[model samples]
Target: MNLIAVYTTLIVVLLIWIGARRNPLMALVEIGREMLRSYKFILIIVGMFSVLALNKYELQIERKMHLAADYTSFVFGLEGHFVRHVQELFYAPWLTPVIVFFYIFMLQSVLAASLGIYLLDKNRVLLYATCYTIILTYAIAIPFYLYFPVNEVWSYVPAGVKFTMLEVFPRFEQEYRPLSGLNNCFPSLHTAISVSMALLAFRSGNRRWMVISGISAVVIVFGIFYLGIHWLTDMLGGTLLAVVSTTVAVKLAKLTLRSGEDRLRVRSRATHTR
Candidate 1:
């Protein structure tokens, strides 16, 4: 058995046990019922995934567009060199673990939010909101990635600054890029999604989850910069995109809920008349 798989299973089991302390089986049954009732939620997720997968293939179309190297360079100007120095100051063997862990955690926020908020807290609305925000981040970021190819700071290494984060996790970096796809650095989807996760977590009533996701978001914002993966302007763009995406997602969710309620009310009235 894979140790990580076994460990994850045990943790989930423990949570289920506690969540349904009086009757674990009944708790699972109730969860099943809820899932059946919320089947549309699953469809929503499927739709989002479909869009992301399409985005990957669509990136080939992006190559025809000109690189915004001059524009991206103008974005940082002298500040890029200054931040590079700041990044170097923190580069050490000791800091590698936290940086790498947080970097991965930032990417995994969607999974964490789904499990943490939906399963642990049992709030589907918050869960969907969190998920949609991440989805929307990708939706909005894709166009920029297609047209505005801002090279990752690391690409500028020998000229301006060293690529600090990748240096620390060279093997992991080498392995991750094939799957992650390079040349999509503008607006930092990592930053946007992490921020959205933090926002959703905080809005959720669960203070513990909020604190954890909030901390993760802050670390990721700093981490991307420290790692030399994003320009400071990219962080700003990501943040703004997050806010817009979350706002739109929440509105659309409310509209969907309202539409469902209206349909249900009409059916109930018709049945009673019958």
Candidate 2:
């Protein structure tokens, strides 16, 4: 199989394994049923996918614009050799693959499975909140990616961090670089998304999902540094973004669902009168 196929299959398997804990087979069926039944649910799913598409388009725009600007120096100036020290302090040949696995696969896997698990639990509020968090996170981060560019820590020689991701996924640049730009390193989306998912999982009240997402977030955050991909400032900014996105998304989701409920009640009353 090709790289994308392999990644997708693995992610699907992981999602099933997690979702299976709570009748996720029914949840899978329910996702379809709900989408067909509720325009609001369908719209939320569309909005989620639309933001992802926008993210891809934004990458293309960034490339065509050729924003040769590099803020790596500013990041390095703020935090000198932090990533290098972290790597040097904990560099292990055996640990590389484990970290790379989480970096490459676990982030996206947990994200996808979170949606499925939410559906399985029948928690529409958290599901909508998760989708909204994703939309908001990308919406805010894309601007920085376009305007304020920062290279990866390893790419910046002054940082003295080695790109450990290369150790395992040597063809990462050739395979994955198309999806992720080399210079899009200001606020680590991996950090933000993983952390935001974990925050939402905690709110989901699913003990299993909470543990899974929490571990995924912590490991991914550490992996970014261990893999020599993101700087300290990037992680800090990402954490802040996660907080803002999650808070706003939760409120927005509640309001949107409440409004939908009110409209449904009004329609019911109208039907009864008729």
Candidate 3:
């Protein structure tokens, strides 16, 4: 089963448990409300995955890198001009991978918002913020991917600079190898997702976790460049995407809340008049 099916099943089970114990009607109503509110986010994610899948079939088209090669190269030159040093301060194989894994997993901000929804019984703000962030990031990224398709500098790094473990990692090689095509490296999804998680952590009032995540994000950003998985320009692009996405998400959340409040006030006044 796909992720949608799995998540739907889990939600159904939770609703069933809620119905069995306290109030079935209220549980159904609550679930319906949440589904409606989050529908846009679900659609965006599905659309992104569909685009990625379809791109896989057009292998010949992807191989050309005609989409955004020159623009990406220019941006990369600007980033490379600022590189001060290439130091390997932290080189633990186990540690880097583990940190990277956790950072990626944290991008599932929906799960965090869901927890807030369950505990506080009102997390529309968090839900809206998370959804908006995801949607905005991909929306902004799609054009850049087209205009500046970049194969990471790491793809052609000097043999001596290549990290040993990364060079040998089959899965990583398969995903990023330039020969296989699909190399849009101007913006690092890793950095965008990491920054998104850090923002969510902060908004959720988990300052301690936010600080830790912030530090981890910085490490991952550096690690990706150091490992040659991304160009310095790619990291900058990722940072820009994250900032734009977060800003847009916040504005959207505020608008949603304001609209909700206006509706509630109108209803209250109508009831009072009656």
Candidate 4:
């Protein structure tokens, strides 16, 4: 695995341990059992990862399309060097690495740990709802990425924002740019996914998970602008998307799971009568 993968895996494992108070291996075994016991669980997991994989493919297609309409000017117009001001206000040599770490590593760690933590706590409803939330997040965001192309704040020179990410990950453009397009700045997924995960965790009834996810979300959101990667408008758009996605995903998960329970209840009654 690459250094990024290794670092994220370590962070995820640590988060799962702290939140669930169990070895991640044991939690994985339980997760596997849960998946085996319910096809719905398996399907939701598959669907969630499928959307993530599709997002990677979408980045490739976006690069090939050479999308010509840069809305960076429009976004900068609305938010007028907000990211630069943030960097100027908060920038520090010591703080940059901390912000960059959260910006890069913590988001994925919290997301991965959310799954293990939910399963270990036997919170099936929240687990399934998270999957749906992820699916909805990408489904909604991808269209904006494809058509409403907005460049990163630092990339628009007029914004006067420096790409602070390069301080820590000097090879960011070489290594990470392929995974993320320069122009996929609107409705920052970093904000949406992290905040949405925290929103779902609040309903999980696992206080530890709630605390962990909550702090991670807040830090990741702040890290966006501090890293000079996102605009104020992007963060605002992402927050709105987070609220809407989690709200809809929770309702849909309850409706879908409740119907499945009803079917199982009917089956149980028919078997007992026979």
lDDT values, one for every candidate: 0.62, 0.83, 0.54, 0.83
Please give each candidate's TM-score.
0.76, 0.90, 0.63, 0.92
Instruction: Point out the higher-scoring one by lDDT: 3 or 4.
Output: 4
Rank the models by lDDT, top first. Answer: 4, 2, 1, 3
lDDT of 2 at 185: 88
Error of 3 at 239 (Å): 1.4
Q: For residues 17-74, write the lDDT of model 4, one tens digit per residue.
A: 9888889877789888977787888888888899999889987777788877778888
Q: What is the C-alpha RMSD of each candidate to the true structure, in Å?
A: 7.6, 6.4, 8.4, 6.2
Q: Predict model 3's lDDT versus the native.
A: 0.54
Residue pairs in collision within model 4: none
Clashes of each: 0, 0, 3, 0
Model 2 weakest 10-residue run by lDDT? 265-274
lDDT of 2 at 22: 56
Better of 2 and 3 by TM-score: 2
What TM-score does candidate 1 get on C-alpha atoms? 0.76
lDDT of 2 by residue, 112-227 (tens): 88778777666777878889999899999999999999998888887888998888988999888888888888789999999999998777666667788899899999999999
lDDT of 1 by residue, 86-144 (tens): 57787777776677667764456344433443444455555566657767777788877
